[model samples]
Target: MRDVNPKEWLALGEDLAPKLKDFDIINPHNFPSYIWAYYVKLRLGERSSAIIWYCHEPLRILYREITDPKGFRFYSKYNNPELKTIDMKAVSQIDHIVCNSRFTANNVEKIFNRAASVCHPGINMVETQDCDRKNFRMVTRIYREKNVERIINAMVLIRETRPDIYENCSFEIVGEGADEGRLKTLVKDIGISNIKFCGFIPDKELPAFYAGAKAIVYIPLDEPFGLVPLEAMFHKTPVIASNQGGIPEKVINGVTGILIDPVVIEVLTDAMQRIYDNPQLANELGTAGRTRVLERFTVDSFINKLEKKFFSLSGVK
Candidate 1:
């Protein structure tokens, strides 16, 4: 697939609008593609059968500016009023809206004043294997909104307060982003050695990482339908995630995994300790997590639901 720069959205839309009419459905993700779809729908006139928007989140930067200014301040400059107006106008023209989670669907309704259907994205379930699940793992972009520092701080507390638990436990932070250097510096300055930054691991290697982990620590601020937890759960690994956003939909506190406030450092530290102390509890949670994935989050289920939505919108049997 060719990469279309955001700057060329209008030109691309104008060029492709005529050709797009032959297609039954125009499904667009993200703002630029949504703009392109909007133009195509306008140009298609009565020929356009359906324009379904699979929104991950509704202009997150705009919403984050209101909900979390400190975490989203870097993106504040890009939150142009004109751009938001254009995006809203485009969204209003869409025939159907689908979101990845109910959390995101609520955000879409609040932001766009439009009802959206929730179709949770699914993952390929990995076969469970017996492995020495020793280390706590986190697989996420090292960004401010991801709340990586909170986990790092939890590590610091664990080291200082509970030396025995800290001695045995290790953390592996996978994936990289702009906040990586700052987080590494913080780790080094504090002289904590148990945490290792694994950088980006290939998708194929992720199952091994998940399978060998004690728990997947995910505490992103208002994440929109986290796939990391689902991937981890598929490997029969429990997730220790934040209560905020779409994570709660996936990680059930005490049943599938533990959920705590994203801001509180001690809450995260205690949850990790609990998992370490109770192997049976951890195993039970892991088993339940895998069962949850098998029941609700299979790729086949996702595709079937999406197909149903498409058929419903297109007026086809």
Candidate 2:
């Protein structure tokens, strides 16, 4: 709000601040905005107040390693940059907080003296006309954190080791990123021509791909809650993904799709081989995954959780 013309919002805030008295300020990935949020809550909390920060690993890992180590360290005051570094005053301002996963919740407790509830991200599912289903495909965002290179390498190995399955299979790389050029080179270097770089297709267009595919393989380093897999499940497409992050919450291993550490070539290739070897097995897993999503991970459930959390934090009914 400060970066974008605060004067415009000044009147609005002035008018609304007294009339609407609920809404705990949350600065997830607590940037400089947290400072302002803290101040606002301090003034507003004659009744109740909160200011929670959700730290992203990118601020600690990729950004520190790849871009700015010095800047990264300096932002540590709020970034969960290190253990026992969160300011005491900031903690006093907050009531409750949202966490990505139980694993991450433990890390948050170790870093910030805050109890964080796991709130997975949600997506709106769209029902679409069925896809051809014969084309077994894999879809993923090409990025460093996602370990896209491993997917490329595994696909190549799949072709070399099992030529029949390779000839029939199609791997689609969706959502472009830093690894686009490198991934393309890897595909050519490995002599795997069945891959397609379908850059930035809308979510609506995804139904055709999901319906037609055997399963979607989302290989990533660590994800909070990889929504893509659940989205694929909504399409009744099974998922084969890495056993990292909050993936287990969505992907029910053998029931949904094979989960492996995508970083290891042997592990990933072996998992793919299992799927390629058994079409009936893949279909069964896909059906189970879809049912799991309908029950556990849907927009309605996410909204209900958010409302309850908001009420608790704001102390407004």
Candidate 3:
């Protein structure tokens, strides 16, 4: 893999275009890679290889109104309009587009006026021995769009209103990002003692955290497709996620886990307390979640769908 800087991708794409012709398929995973792929496809006109873009989400800055209208205005305001034009051009030249969820596919279609196939990514099913459930966990990057602060606010409400539940419960934040300092400051300023910032945990060690958690709290604002809840479910841990975005598709409200409008602190606090007060309900949700993952979101299922898409695009079958 070439370690080319993203800022220099356009120039390097000119140099690397000829070499990419050797591959049967050119699959670019992100926007910068899509730009490079566009360069290669342009240089090697009438090429045998097909370019497939695995879009996590369309250029988020272009769809700020839908993704995060209230927040992230700074990024949307300062972003160059040329990037949107270039991304649209690159998307038009691609042979096929696959999105991680239907929500994302719809956004791509709206942006590019092009249809994209939905292919949900899968995860390894993790098995863990039962242990006493402790803290509620959140394993996500502490970004502005993630809505981590919503949960913090909910915790404060829980502390004030439901002291009994709050006394027995603690929240474990298990990831780091650009907003980490601000979030830590928020926690400190509020004087919440139960919330712990455990920094970044290795992938292999994540299961232990999941196993020990009563339930995973994943309430991101307009998440295109979230994997943290799936990972938590795989460890037989219940999930409390937002009702918005592709999360509702993965988590069945009141079945696999509880879903709420995370913007409302009272609703979020109620869900947390419900999960904490009732261990039987938590266990039931956890079991159903694992079953859902096994039946629908396994690695084998994901690979089968992806393999068919690859063969059809490459004319291998």
User: Among these predicted structures, which one has the highest TM-score?
Assistant: 1
Clashing pairs in 1: none
- Report lDDT (CA) for all predictions: 0.85, 0.65, 0.84
Q: Can you write out model 2's per-residue Cα lDDT over 1-317, one digit (the tens) per residue?
A: 11433343344434544543465445435433443454455445674344555543322432333223324122233334322132445544555657656655655565555677776656687888767665555566666776777777777787878888678877776788777998888788878788888888886788787887766778776565667888888887768887876787778889987888766898877776777778788788878988887887888987787667767765657
lDDT of 2: 0.65
Distance from true location, Cα of 97 in model 3, Å: 0.6
lDDT of 1: 0.85
Structural similarity to truth (TM-score) of each candidate: 0.93, 0.79, 0.92
lDDT of 2 at 45: 60
Off by over 4 Å in 1: 1-7, 65-74
Please report how far candidate 3 places residue 49 from its true position, in Å. 1.0
Candidate 2 Cα misplacement greater than 4 A, ranges: 1-36, 43-48, 52-58, 61-92, 136-138, 312-315
- Candidate 3 matches the true fold with a TM-score of 0.92
Question: What is residue 61's positional error in candidate 1, in angstroms?
Answer: 2.3
Candidate 2 residue pairs in clash (backbone atoms < 3 Å): 28-54
